[model samples]
Target: MANIKIITDSTCDLSSAIVKELNIAIVPLYVVFKDVSYRDGVDITAAELYSKVNKLKELPKTSAPSPKDFHEVFKPYIDNGDDILYIGLSSRLSSTIQNAKIAANEFPEGRIKIIDSFNLSTGIGLLVLMAADFVKEGLTLKEIFARIQESLPKVKTSFVINTLEYLHKGGRCSAIQSFVGGMLKIKPIVQVVDGRMILGHKTRGKIEKSLRSLIELTMKDKDRIDLKRIIITHSEADEEAKLLKKGLEEALSPKSIIITSAGCVISSHCGPKTVGIIYLTK
Candidate 1:
């Protein structure tokens, strides 16, 4: 059997250390600012992207990688006779997976398998980590793929945003909604549902208060949450992310709670001071 290699896009929000340790390959998306495009994670860090946004007072446009970009990432592994298991960004959210499908057509059939995570950030990262473990246990590529599909719906992915301005800029929110929400200091807890982001609920208060509400909401289903690993992803919200990790720790005492910074592609839409909690369920 050919070795199975796991590949995921940069939007997984996994730490560079974790990616290197797991031997996971990442194909980055693009972050475009005023006609200048930089590969997410490769050319622009989230901090730099935020800096640019703050300076220009304009949100950058994010884009999926082209089919050619995916092709290049897939080619070397194909030549090595390894089987590829690519877990990508949600199909409903971006064309990253679709482009990956287009690239797969350039390679021999049966060697490449593309899966839509139907989730983003460390939500996708959780699935990729599971696939990596499956590979370690000597499972076939097909087995890993099947297991990932089974695990998709069990992922609980959600975030609380500090402001709606980014949503308005991205056209996900109406200007009036943004203006009103901003004035009210309304924070929305956006949940991933059926591969699309759905407004879960709204909390009216300071961000810290909203984060506490988010923790309460997440812990409601704690009994069903898989304790193996949990992820806290943030965009320029280190302290807030740490608070989330601490809350989960005190409540669930999960085996692993990883804090990773969201990359440019994710940060571009959610904007600064956004934090999300991601995990798989039992």
Candidate 2:
């Protein structure tokens, strides 16, 4: 092995068990509400954030981890003489990767490598796991980097927003538009395209209809899917996510399916009841 250490941001939506099992390090971002700041995964959790949002009737603002924060996380690894690989959320979505780059410059040139996952939630988690797999194969840093770079474009990150309240509050849509959409129960399918969230299809009626529409869209080109692994992630949406998982299991029959909750960063933006299926396509 190459004495490698893997680091990722809290937006990866990976569980504590998996992070510990993989021996991965996570640098947390910040979620600020009512002038109080909480570390993404450390101080705040998805359910707590959502409860506050509903109680306060406002969405929290999220900030990327500072370069100094990354330095703190990188220090122990560098002192141990281990080469560090930090996979971060999209530069376009948040400045997490850019800040990591700034922190990496504080150390020796080849000691740290920062990868912009160009993804969020478990989509980034999948990429982190992929890198860990390559590490177990005894690949050098150079080889691992090459493999990761190649796999970046294949990572699919997306979600179905159960409500547009946050979107309207964020001014992504007009109040009247949101009011009308909410009245009609219009759920928008949102996906990461070129590192930013874009509204995809508008599915009307109940949330279940939108989820089925999402599954249909996912399996429309089922033949091209890798089917090796799939992730279903949500924000305060256990039953809805499991329903999506049920359909996906019947359709793709992936080798493994992982379900997890969105972390502070993801939950801050998407609000509650946001669910999505993330997978790689061949």
Candidate 3:
């Protein structure tokens, strides 16, 4: 058995099969709509979350898993006498990491190390996958922590909001301004910088162009890329994701490219038709 266990929250946006295949533990977040709460990626799905958003004309609130939720996932590993390394969603975006810390503090001198990924979606997922590699390599917990920390600065995460409606509805931008952007066919790209989301280049006309912009930016440092793998995460943006996958294959020549749909926690904010290209640099 591996000496260390890997855990993450749903905001990682990793596909269920990959998570299960890697034997990674994921504690889900919550998506609440009209007084009803559903566990992200469990009771609720991205399609259901998007359906409610468009149908209700409002954003569903997403909450981090409680301390008890963390305990349930952690206790099993602790009982098995395994060390844990949890890669959490950006604290700037969610309080999932904080709750995990609280739960860890209550354990009997538990051996849990939590790293704030300082990123979102596939951004954090990339880090978790790397940790899984470390475990498979028979690396110690201390070594995995050092390597992940060393890799933090080189991880790049970015996405484009196909429409401004979701951002504006969440008060991230403005509804009126987003309506104007829609009228003008403005698609803005967002990048995670120091754990916060910031606007990047804005594309006009098509989402294909926006996706191209993301690929171009990622390839800006092509020579520095660790093109072993990459992630094309989206919220029902399959066509654009395909375009990105093709582009990455042609441009960066990555070995593995994964496409995963966002769950309720992410779809609650990014809405439908959002796509992000996440990668790591050497």
Candidate 4:
């Protein structure tokens, strides 16, 4: 058995199968609609969240897990004599990272390490996957921590939102402006830079151009890519994601490519047709 255990929150957006295979523990965030609340991946799913968003009068709101929630999730393994490494969503975007840190302090005598991934969704998922691989290879908790810290900046993520309506509804963009842009069918290509989302380029014609732009950016270092570990994640847009995957494979010809749904926590913000790519670089 691995001496160290990996833990992360639902915001990481990793699938249940991968989590189980990696022996990773996930603490769920909360999603509230009207008067009802549900645990992120437990009671709410990406498809369900998008369905509700389409029918509801108002957009649903998301809440980060509290320190108590983190404590509850951590106590199990820590008490069982496993060293814990709690990787979390970006500190810039949510207080979840801070909450995890607070909970880690609560067990001062136990071996627990909380790390702010400085990323969200599949961005964090990619990092957690790398950390899990290291742990499975029998690396010590300290070595795994050092590996994650060294690799954080080398991971690149870029995405394209089919429409800005979701960002507007979530208060990440101006409603009136995004609404107007959506009517024009403008697709925005965005990238995660310095731990925050920023606009990269925009096209008024098709999502294909936006997707092409993402690939071009990723393939800029085509001669030296470690293609064995490329990942693609989307928000309820499997068709588009499939198309993007096909295009990426033909272009880069990576050794492996992983495609999965971005969890409800991110889908809640990016909405239904967001597509993204994550890759590890030298």
Report model 2's TM-score to 2 decimal places: 0.97
Q: If both were scored by TM-score, which would come out higher, candidate 2 or candidate 4?
A: 2
lDDT of 3 by residue, 1-282 (tens): 446889999999999899999999889999888889999988978887878877987898878999999999999898898888999988888888899999989776638888999998988999999999988888888899989989888889888889888888788887777988999999888899999999778888888888888888888888988888899999998988898899889987788999988877877777778999888999
Task: Name the better of 1 and 2 by lDDT.
Answer: 1
Q: Give lDDT tens digits, candidate 1, residues 161-229.
A: 998989999899899999999999999999999999998789998888988988998998889998888
TM-score of 4: 0.95
lDDT of 4 by residue, 18-122 (tens): 999988999998889997888998998889887887788567888889999989988888788889988888888888998998889988554887778878887
lDDT score, candidate 3: 0.87
Question: Between candidates 1 and 4, which one is better according to lDDT?
Answer: 1
lDDT of 2 by residue, 1-282 (tens): 439999999999988999999999999999899889999889988888888888998888889999999999999989988999888898888889999999999999888988888888887999998999989989988888888888888888779998888888876778987898899899999988877788888999888999999998898769988888899999989999999999999988889898988998888778789999898878
lDDT of each: 0.93, 0.89, 0.87, 0.84
Q: Candidate 1, 46: how far from true, in Å?
A: 0.7
- What clash pairs does model 4 have? none
Q: Where does candidate 2 have its weakest 10-residue lDDT segment? A: 168-177
Ranked by lDDT from best down, the candidates are 1, 2, 3, 4
Segments of candidate 2 deviating more than 4 angstroms: none
Model 1 misplacement above 4 A: none
Total residue pair clashes for candidate 3: 0
